[model samples]
Target: MELDRHGLLSLYKTMTTIRHFEERGIPETGQRGMSASVHSSAGQEAVPTGMCANLSDDDYIGSTHRGHGHCIAKGVDPKLMMAELFGRATGPNKGKGGSMHISDMSKGMLGTNGVVGASIPLAVGAALTAKVKKNGKVAVAFFGDGASSQGVLHESMNLASIWKLPVIFLCENNGYAMSTPSEYGVSTTHVSDRAQGYDMPGINVDGMDVFAVYDASAQAVARARAGEGPTLIEAQTYRYYGHTVFDNPLTYRSQEEEDHWRARDPLKQFRDVVIPQGDITAEELDRLDAEAEALMEEAVKFADESPLPAPVELYDDVYVDYPVDMMKRGVNMSV
Candidate 1:
């Protein structure tokens, strides 16, 4: 799939935005003394950027814990996401759903799941809705290699295949599922190889290369939109940080391994490919990098200035019609 200049630039912009958001937001969590678990997707920007590039605001996407990239790529506002992480009332979930659960229904981003492989069934259900309505929309399920082993994934795939649901089963195989390496957990050499059992096309691509991921996802998305059932895509990628913010990756993986993946960073790889073609310049990329940094700075400011959710409204979203007076009375009730 050949992308025009505008498409190429957009891809670069989205990837940079995700990278900057993760880089800036993770530290802010620590500074705020937030106990919420944040799984950084710094090294896996290309996977979401490429996949979501093929989707529209109406297309649905179910995300995993390491889903900041997925949210940004799917067009969720970074400032609102930052506010959510900061536990502000202005957040998409009104400060209730933190890092792992951040969701924006307006952008068609189904909530990011904290459970392994949980997003798979959600995406399948969305696809079934699209198929029933004949809405011409597709859904995507983003999961990690660790979640690939979950029974829900296999069950979703089988049902999607039989029902011909318009969904893409995307696996961001970041070498490790938490601390356990893919080789130790997955029986197959590539996770995509498992697609055979479900009678779907399995594709494995270079997750670090945005172009490769974009091309593969373009085909898979097209297939789904054409009512050809689901496609399984395994992106061979790596994560720079640990499973969560507090975990240290060095304990399980070597510094050399981390350095190897960092060298092939998605942003750098995009530059290496585009600059040589003479259509896009290094200065242009640098400008985009600067803009992304500035954007994140503004997002941080927005989050910092935002107010926390009021204590009395705790049950507002939880109950459809809970009485306000009951909330006030409950607030004063002794335990």
Candidate 2:
């Protein structure tokens, strides 16, 4: 877990990229402009960026609704992701699956789910595939504190443990599950504590620190590849915005609480900890910031200029095959 200068620089740049992308995209959700619902991963950038830093393109990751960071960290092109959000034909799913369901199989992103706790089972399935194939790849499922209560999560955990599937259950404990806090919904003291029931190693981490997440994930990934069972990691973080872009968190939580987390802003902490210590210079960090902002600006322009799905192509990507006559009707029936 010894850090190199290059590794620290990549972490800093990736976290900044995720934060900037979410900031630009999620703000368009007020009904005045954007096409789809946006769930911001503003404050929680460190978790995915750090975890995914240890992943390869062949390693699978299942993500939550607020998964722009996960996608970016998993080596997906943000331009394509932004295009998907804009609902353009050039998008990842050609505008069919928007913010909630964006995916890139080539990069091993299973897909971001709109249904809470849904990705856990999917990640287990992906890990099962890897295990059966004997591929040296591990699957990671990124869920929130709310998903910790779902039956599917436990079932997935149990199955993975019994089969010794190469999977990692990562819970981003951001305090609240929508308007309701984790204290209100979850009976467990911490989400990682539930891992004991499934006989897996449970770890609690500071999601605000990228290095911590990377180190823990590296160990879990090594264990899985070595034919060991799954591990559950609960990252203690906070969401800077409301649950969704439309909801105002002020009604449920105090500004003081929000301000407290803001003071520990992951991006700022990275700079403060690394720059003065000489791991990275301010000039290099600024260059990365400029590059990220410029990249996002280009993604917006590319999305704006891209075309929408054509009428005759409605059946495209819908199914493997269908009756010629049924498809010729230019209608969508198979939901």
Candidate 3:
């Protein structure tokens, strides 16, 4: 699976964009005094970048709390996403779903789940829909090392295997599940190893290396599209920031450990691998980086300028068919 020059640049662009989005958006949360804390996915850009590169707008994906990268990779507009974080009416969910709950059904992003392992079944259900419709589309479930132990993950894997659903169970094992390290939590050395129990192919890839992730995901996606069962992919990645905006990782992990992972930064790794190939130059990558920065600037401006949701419309979108008047009428009634 040789990627063309365009494909290589696309991968670089997506990763850079995600990096910039997180770097810029995290600060906005603070400046705006947002109540909801953002879970930054700064260093784990490669996992979503590589996996979503293999998917189309019609394909589905379920994301975790740290899922802005997933949304960006899956073709959701960053401007809309930023607006959502700002709680603006122009947001994808009309300011209802904040940072952790950002979603765009049109882009096949089911929604980022606040619950640890909840998104696993959402992707599986989407896979079953694709299977029933014979749409040839696949779904990817993006979770973390902590969620790997959740029962929903195991149950979803088993169901997908039995039904031969076109889904990929992607576990972004970033060493720790919030504060709990993988060593103290997971029984297996690698989360993918558990896939054997469900009779699916289990793969462990260097999540920091975009090319490695791309290759593994491409194969898994191909297998799923061909009617094969689900594949469990454990990406050994790391998050540069704490689990959420406020939690300091230094409490549980050492600076030396964080520094070690930071040394092999995914963006730098991409440059190291691609620049020498002679197809993409340093100037080109710099230009892409500048473009990503500019895009985030515009996203922030768009979000900041967008109006807040109107208070009277609070009942709007609560139900698909319910009248707003009916909901307002019942608002003051006791149960």
Candidate 4:
């Protein structure tokens, strides 16, 4: 919880990198004609950086569709992420999977999926694997408030508690699930309350406060690594953009609400704390910001020049082994 100068610098760098990457990466991807519009993690930058700050590269993390921050915090190369967003062969998924499917397993980033809440069970499964192997690793699932409605989330929580899996369910509750306010869809006001049903510990955190998220996640991680069961953490946060870029939009939320959240941005809060408490200089922070901007520019260039996937690769990664039922049904193999 007490961040040394080095840790604070790293935290600032990560949050800034994530914020810049999403801001620039999405537009560039659109310009390049990637079919799917991005689902951004604009105002919710701290949840990933703070949670992953306490984790090692060996620890596993499963991220949702709005996952650019998780990827950056988990040590994914910005160039590769940008390449994936741009749908270039130089991407982490070799241009096969776009933003929603970006992954770097070597860095313990399982994957990001378009389907909401799917990562919850995947992370719990990874936690169980870590437990069985006695690897002293913990798995974290980064999901959204909307994802809490999925049936699988509850199932995953119940199983993690019953088996004492080393997992953390992090719900980034940004007030709304797409256009619907969370209060309208959710039965409970606090998403963390769901953990009580499975008899596991739960904590609610200010998602915009990077240090608070870091401190709270540290406790949950420590308990998990000590063989305690999973913990549910609901982080209250906001997003500045629509669910995706292609949305018909125009009437869901107000500009005032967006402005309110922007004023309380996590990166700004981190800067305020570090400048006073950690002896960080604004000039130094500006240097880091410039570096982030430069790196992202290079990433865009790399993605722009990278090759596209070969046509033959369409059926290559379909399955480790083609299913017998699939063959029996005589389904069309080409995608």
Ranking by lDDT: 1, 3, 4, 2
Tens-place lDDT per residue, model 1, 1-335, is 78999999999999999999999998997799874489999999999999999999999999999999999999999999999999999999999988999899999999998998998999999999999999999999999999999999999999999999999999999989889999999999999999999999999999999989999999999999999999999999999999888889999999999999999999999999899999999999899999999999999999999999887557677677777676667456432
Encode model 4's per-residue lDDT on 176-276: one tens digit a residue. Answer: 88898899888997999998998988899999999999999999999999998899999999987888876643478887888889899998898787788
Error of 1 at 333 (Å): 3.8
Report the Cα lDDT for residue 286, model 1: 90
What is each predicted model's overall lDDT from 0 to 1?
A: 0.94, 0.89, 0.93, 0.89
Ranking by TM-score: 3, 1, 2, 4
| Tens-digit lDDT string for candidate 3 (49-80) | 99999999999999999999999999999999
Clash pairs detected, candidate 3: none
Best by TM-score: 3
Q: What's the true lDDT of residue 176 in model 3?
A: 87
| lDDT tens digits by residue: candidate 2, 93-118 | 88888889989999999999999999
Model 3, residue 110: distance off in Å is 0.6
Whose lDDT is higher: candidate 1's or candidate 4's? 1
Which ranges in model 2 have alpha carbons more than 4 Å from their true place?
A: 29-32, 327-335
